[model samples]
Target: MALPKPGTPVRGSTTGRPIMALLDLLGRRWVLRILWELREETLTFRELRERCDAMSPTVLNQRLRELREADIVVLEEPYGYALSKQGRQLLEALMPLQRWSEQWQKKLAAKADQES
Candidate 1:
């Protein structure tokens, strides 16, 4: 599927809200892992593939293309691929979600313990 662009209809939505578009893109497999791998350092194509073990180069290529189209990732030749400014901001935006997931994990563990 094409990278969901703002103002364009995306999966599960007709209104084309930016949030929905974002979700559609991020919902794709390996997209988040790519972002996370590039969070701290720029990596070459091979390096990125190594970081995301088991991810086929074909899929990575496609995801990178989509991310670049979305302005989330950029090619910084000599060094390799890196997150664009907006990509960094997007990662920052996801921090809250990470915290929530951690909290949710703890809650689930507690519930499991209670049932034990």
Candidate 2:
């Protein structure tokens, strides 16, 4: 299939297949969380799920597959999942987002306290 150029209409899937497909992949259960768990250290699948508060095994496996396919994660020598170099780069790009989330979470908690 010819890929649509930027600003051109995407021909498949109502919301435009490319963006929707990306979002769909990202939106899978525990996908981002799995990557987040690997931010600092690699972990076996079992360990990853434990860190993720016991995410479903099936879902975790699926996310791992997708992440590996996207080259954002790799199964290393010890056979544990670790963020790929590309994934580390992506994480660096999201450092600002972490700061924003910290601020946003505090604000949200303060708002909740005020409401209570």
Candidate 3:
């Protein structure tokens, strides 16, 4: 399905602001995980499913279709599946967030230890 355009209603935002629409799409279960798994190399459907801890094939296929439609992923002649240029750029933008998540994970662990 074509993604909802900006200014159209999205999952959480009636205004469908671009950012909100993006968040809505990215927030879907396994979406980010799929993107992360594809960061280093193209993987076939089976490989991706295995990497994703055997996520149901149906869900994986659905997410893949959506990503392809969004121009965030493409299937190469023999490369299986890889991120498109826009997808790579988006991953680059998310790098800082990934770094922050590592630190946040540490902080959470420390807090849990203190409580324990």
lDDT of each model, Cα atoms only? 0.94, 0.78, 0.92
Order by lDDT, highest first: 1, 3, 2
- Scored by TM-score, the top model is 1
Candidate 1, 14-100: lDDT as tens digits: 888999999999999999999999999999999999999958989999999999999999999889999999999999999899999
* Residues 1-116, model 3: lDDT tens digits: 44755689998888999998889889888999999999999999999999999999999999999999888999986869999999999999999999999999999999999999
Cα lDDT tens digits for candidate 2, 17-111:
65655455555667778878999998998899999999789878877877888788999978799999989987787789899999999999999
Candidate 3: lDDT of 28?
A: 87
Ranking by TM-score: 1, 3, 2
lDDT of 1: 0.94
Candidate 3 has what TM-score?
0.91
Output the better candidate (2/3) by TM-score: 3
